[model samples]
Target: MLNLSRLSTSLTKHGAHKIALLIRDHDPDKVLSLLWGKVPGINIEEVQARKNLSAGTTGLTVPSVWKEAKARGSETINALVLIAIIFSHHTLIAAMRQGAKSDFTGRITRDVELDGKAYTNFAHTLEELGYSTKHTQQYVDFDLQRLFKIPDLNSLALTLLALKMKTAGWDGTGDLKQLLIDNGFHEVFATDEDQFEAWLSSGKLTAPSFEDADYFLDAAKDSAPAGKYKFKAGHKTKQTGSVSVKSPLTKKTAQLLHNYIQNKFDEQLVAIHGRDCVGCEVATGLGTSIDVVVETAKLRWFYEIKVGKTLKACIRQAIPQLLEYAYWSAEPVKVDRLVIVAVHKLDKQSETYLQKLRDDFKLPLYYEQFVDA
Candidate 1:
């Protein structure tokens, strides 16, 4: 995703190392060494060794769109153009937004066709963010490294390409002959000649779907985040006094964290309760939905998710929403407890504020913090 403000600082401070972290889950250092140590010209051993644990991986899932692309590729396209487009999308966006150079969409305007079309501001912020891992290294052997068993970057790229085309107004079934021109690298999308023509006319070729493409999956670990959770606060039984320090919030960074937190909370609830009883994003009768709702024979819980820099900010936003969701309608949804799920726990002062809400008004509201596991 194009969180350009923080991304600029991240790249300048850490080089490709931080971005590489988001692009891999299992021993990213191993991939770094392979790409850098093995090739001295582009070697980045020093970059690989710098340990900045704060540069965490993006928690995302593999969108189903890539599955269809992979399946259709056996006939029409090979891996090269597919891979080229990945780096292309990342670089092209960078070129347009961050003033970085790109091979496909040259320095602002070497190609007139894209010159009028490729301005950064014209693209919606969400469109710019889709399928991006915040950054991509424009290496020639991008496909080789992607095929080396990592799914984070590739999944993001194809989905990104689709967004770019949608912005450019290219049709899925449109003639791709103009796209088949030689940019000096073995003829673009020329992996299968006979099948390319067949696919061109057959209209079976598909682009990566935008749905769920925002997730950056950690394919190495079944989409689980690295490191054990530092602290957790949900109910008084599992609560802890300690809280996480404030972290930065970019538009893309916040969304990635929010989705990851929601999914993790879903898993935790299922483990504590049971799948049949736990419902996520359940729509209430009021036409609004709760992030995570749990129902047992005896009681029910309404959960609201809020990700913010401070516990106070999260609580302020979550409390009102939970209240309205629980009591807004005449036939209000049954709720024994109203819980708030957030990124950090309360500080002493903030904890006192929440306690007063409980003691004075006797609100059945509770607090919970999300941590990596």
Candidate 2:
């Protein structure tokens, strides 16, 4: 069985970013080339090396150096897109490894055939999913990437549904694509969850590459230049007028600030908990958006992210947004913690003021900081 009902639970945007050392920073030009052999800036030798490495094996990956190139790319980076492509790369590898090397000549019988042979239910399922079309590596890449789109895990659920039903000797009564879109979509993953959890415990499928990210991710960051380095201004969408000022937001700076939050704060929480519980730009129904919202078994936290502000100023601007949305939203909401995130650490005076708010005023406020890498 191919159970992936819980697949998106622990897969975070940042965790995906660290899946493969060979994966680039998602320069916009090469973002579409996330497939194994299709990526630019990598040599044939590097491709073969990655291919030869076994699934789930732990070692420092040796991908081609791409540091200098990222510094020179044209398009400004979107952190979300970067992680999306990272996840795409691993999805391709996982499917190919299993389809090519796994010994499970699957049990379900199929009505279709592919490549004139290798016509087990497994191969047939791949075919019906369009994985066997053209039989070129490119088609396989397309089919695999077509499986999962981050922030929308239904594609993943449908892919898994097709695989499972086909393997269980599905009679081919309905079109696979129609069977998916026609159903109550959330109900689709919900209703089948525990029924397919057995596959997870029995080790029937390989864990995703983003799982158990216990390796070093900060190596490149450690070597990266210390900050105050200037960015050429690109676009400015700074929240001005009455909404929120006190800080200016340029396109590149906004990207960099968001990238920092995802990497430093968001990734750590997700590694311990899961991605399904974390959200960015979360709407609070009170005509406001939160920077990040992380929910766990015991707690739900609302984060307000501010960059280019001093510790005092960041806290000042963040408090109003956090309080207004968390308490006065359209519905009942529980806020376990309120975090003020900035680029600078709090001075003693600022720390004492925050502590006073927490202890004396009974606010669940806290502070977090992330300096440039």
lDDT of 2: 0.41
lDDT of 2 at 129: 35
Pairs clashing in candidate 1?
A: 1-132, 1-134, 60-216, 60-217, 233-368
lDDT of 2 by residue, 98-119 (tens): 3331122111122221222222
Instruction: Estimate every model's Cα lDDT from 0 to 1.
Output: 0.43, 0.41
TM-score per model over all chains: 0.35, 0.32
Residue 50, candidate 1: Cα error in Å is 43
lDDT of candidate model 1 versus the reference: 0.43
Kindly report which residue stretches of model 2 are placed more than 4 angstroms away from their true locations once superposed. 1-255, 330-332, 371-373
Q: After aligning candidate 1 to the native by TM-score, how far in Å is the CA of 159 from where it should be?
A: 38
Candidate with the greatest lDDT versus the true structure: 1
